[model samples]
Target: MIALDIENVTKSFGGVRALTGVTLSLNEGERLVLLGPNGAGKTTLFHSISGNILASSGRISLFGDDITQLPPDARARLGLARTFQITNLFAQLTVLENILLAVCGAQKLTFKFVRPLDRYDDIQKRARALLEEWNLVDAADRLVRNLSYGEQRQVEVVMALSGEPRILLLDEPTAGLSPAETLRVMEMVRKLPRDMTIVMIEHDMDVAFEIADRIAVMHQGRVIAEGDEAAIRGNQQVSDIYLGVE
Candidate 1:
């Protein structure tokens, strides 16, 4: 089944266009990596899909349902989750508290002012399960601000998973990590359920090739090449853009 369909999407900022007629599709449970030089419109496409920014022209569908007009929250409710290139978390909150808040938000329990959050057994259960399942119990009580950068990235991924999303968009999940930290994240991603579809933007060539079932190379607001590892590896345009090969 097609999990996401982005057809003829475009995004413009005043006189400049960030994405131009970008079209891509992902199958259910497939892993797609977006490869590009800086300013290739990778993040812009992500924003469009996640509803952070609306496309100037085109159609986006999630599971055959047109979601081009939906807001971010509405899309979240429909099983879409994403992580930013930067860490998005409550620095002062402990890991457990952060997970609790994410669970509450995902379940839309933030408006329940009459009931204390702790009183919600279901929410607490879900948070605890997430911590245990992700092997984050050891740092459950530590402040996010106190955790290492790599650990914080892992926490962000766990938070994204709290909603049980069918499709996940990750923007540079291992951007600033050390080699060891990168390996840890790669292992974590490898352990994800095979049923979850993932689309990621990665600058690390090794990481991109290792995790991607297919790759799409973007350059100057367009997808210039796409295929499996071998096909992408041999594409002259991709080589010219990234490796300066003739």
Candidate 2:
């Protein structure tokens, strides 16, 4: 089944066209990576889909329902979740507290602040399980500010997953990590449920090739090429333009 469908989506910032006539679709459980050089509109496309930015023209649908008019929180409620390229976490909170807060946020109970924090036992349990699944159990009690960069990324991933969205959008998830850390994040990504649809924008071809079931290359605000790993690797246009081949 098609999990996401974007048709002729275009966005502009004043006189500058950020995304132009872009159309793409993803099937359930499919992992798609968007590849491009800097300023290729990769992030623009992501923001458009996640409702962080509205498209100037075109349609976006999630699971066959048009979501063009929905806001980001509404999109999240409809099983769409995204992580940004930069880490966004509660610096002063413990790792466990951050996850618990995410769980509360997902449940729409974040406004119930007068209650004791310990009242959310189920949230804590689920958060701990998520940490353990991501191999972050040992760091759960540490303050988020005290953790390593890679560990903080893992925490962000857990927060993204806490809502159990059907479609996951990740933006440069492995950025700033060492090779070993990048591989670890990739491994965790691999362990995600097979029924979850994933769309990511990545600059790292190695990381994109490793996790992507298919790759779409964007250039100058358009989808220039798209195919599976081997097909993309062999495409002359992709090689000459985006892949830096002569």
Candidate 3:
């Protein structure tokens, strides 16, 4: 089953091209990682899929439904979710509170301020389960601002999961983390429900290859090579650009 389909997608900023006729498809429940050097248009492809930016040409479909021009929030409402390369979370909110907000937002209850946060019994239960699964139950009440950087990033992941997205785009989820912290995140991602599809952009070679079922290598605004780990490791072109031959 195909969960995502990108056909000849392109993005241009005036005369400069960010993504050039990129075409790719992702299967349901597949863990796909995008590998490339900086400015390779990896993030540009992500932004296009997430509806953060419009593609200059071509179409993007989610679960067989055309969503090329769908606005970001509309796409999100239809079970598409993504995280940024940088951490984006509510710093003033507690870990539990942040999850609660995500649940409420996903349910279109964000404007329902008439009731207290605790009144949403179902959302609260879901939030607690996420906290337990992410192993942050002990810090449920800690404000995100007070947690360590790694912990905060975990909270970001928790919030993204709280919505139960069908397809999740993780952009550099472990970027800037210490080696130990990165392994902790790797474990978390490994434990995620297998039914959820993940398309991730990761610069960590070890982590990227370890978790990826297939990898798409982007270069100069296009996908130069795509295959399983062994094929990617042996590709001459991929070695020339992103992976140094040495």
lDDT of 2 at 172: 88
TM-score of 2: 0.93
How would you encode candidate 2's per-residue C-alpha lDDT over 1-246 as one tens digit per residue? 899999999999999999999999999999999998788899999999999999999999999889997899888888998899878899999999999888878867233444566547767788888888888888989999998888888889889999889999998888999888888888889999999999988888888998999999998899988998888888787778764662
As a TM-score, model 3 comes out at: 0.92
Best by TM-score: 1
TM-score of each: 0.95, 0.93, 0.92
The C-alpha lDDT values of all candidates are 0.92, 0.88, 0.87
Tens digits of per-residue lDDT, candidate 1, 30-145, equal 99999999999999999999999999999999988899988998888878999999799999999999999888888782244545645478789999999999899999999999
Q: What lDDT score is found at residue 175 in candidate 2?
A: 90
Q: Give the range of the ten consecutive residues with the poorest summed lDDT in model 2.
A: 109-118
Residue 74 displacement (Å), model 1: 0.8
What's the lDDT for residue 30 in model 2? Answer: 96
Candidate 3 vs. truth: CA RMSD? 2.5
| Each model's Cα RMSD | 2.2, 2.6, 2.5
- Give lDDT tens digits, candidate 3, residues 173-217: 888888888988889889988988999999977899999999998
Cand. 1 TM to true fold = 0.95
Q: Which ten residues in a row have the lowest lDDT in candidate 1?
A: 109-118
**Order of models, best TM-score first:** 1, 2, 3
